[model samples]
Target: MKTIDQTQQEIVEEFSMFSDWMDKYEYIIDMGKNLEQLPDDFKKDEFLIPGCQSRVWLVPEFRDDKVFFKTDSDAIITKGIACLIVRIFNGRTKEEISKSKLFFIEKIGLVQNLSPTRANGLASMVDKIYRYVK
Candidate 1:
């Protein structure tokens, strides 16, 4: 299996191919479209991410000392962003996730392109993912 850093690097490379923010945004929406849907049972109020302009549900599972994430979002771009995070962090150890830095976010220019509300929502998503390990 690829390491989280390797996956992140791959994502960065993928995003780097796009010359404009519009293409990047479209790709993000596509990525979100492909993310596995979270189950209805897990989409409770408790699972909802706070501070998001759109509803996002993230659930974590610990199996065989590895962490896995399942996520869904109401907003297309946000869902795609969440999917990117889940792709990187899923199957990693809690220690790896807790210690890792998400340099890809800035490298891909995702934060700068995002509206402030969306950016805050992204932060909240990351925070919630970290909370899952705690």
Candidate 2:
């Protein structure tokens, strides 16, 4: 399996291909479209991320020492951001997930481009994932 860094590098390279933020935004929306559908049962208040402008739900499962995540958001961009994070951390060991620095977020200019609310939401998502690891 590819390490989280490898996966993040791949995402950075993919984002680098876009010349403009419009294209990047479209790509993110496409990624969100491809995200696995989260079941209705998992969209409870317990799974809801608190800092998001949209309703974001995350459910994690730990199996054989690996963590798998399922996430969804009412907003397309938020869902796409979640998809990026899920791609990096899903199916990874808890130790691996916990230690990742998530440099791709900066390399892809996601943090700088995001609105303050969205940026906070992104941090919240990362925090939620780490909480599951502990």
**lDDT, candidates in the order shown:** 0.84, 0.85
lDDT digits (tens) for residues 23-121 of candidate 1? 999999999898878889999998788878788888888899999888998888889988899899999998888888877888899765334465347
List the lowest-lDDT window of 10 residues for candidate 1: 111-120
Clashes of 2: 0
lDDT of 2 at 27: 98
How far residue 19's Cα lies from its native spot in candidate 1, in Å, is 0.8
- Among all candidates shown, the one with the greatest lDDT: 2
> Model 2, residue 3: what's the lDDT?
93
Any idea how many clashes model 1 has? 0
Candidate 1: residue 132 Cα off by (Å): 2.3
User: How well does candidate 2 match the true structure in TM-score terms?
Assistant: 0.92
- For each of the candidates, the C-alpha root-mean-square deviation to the true structure, in angstroms, is 2.0, 1.8
- lDDT for model 2 comes to 0.85
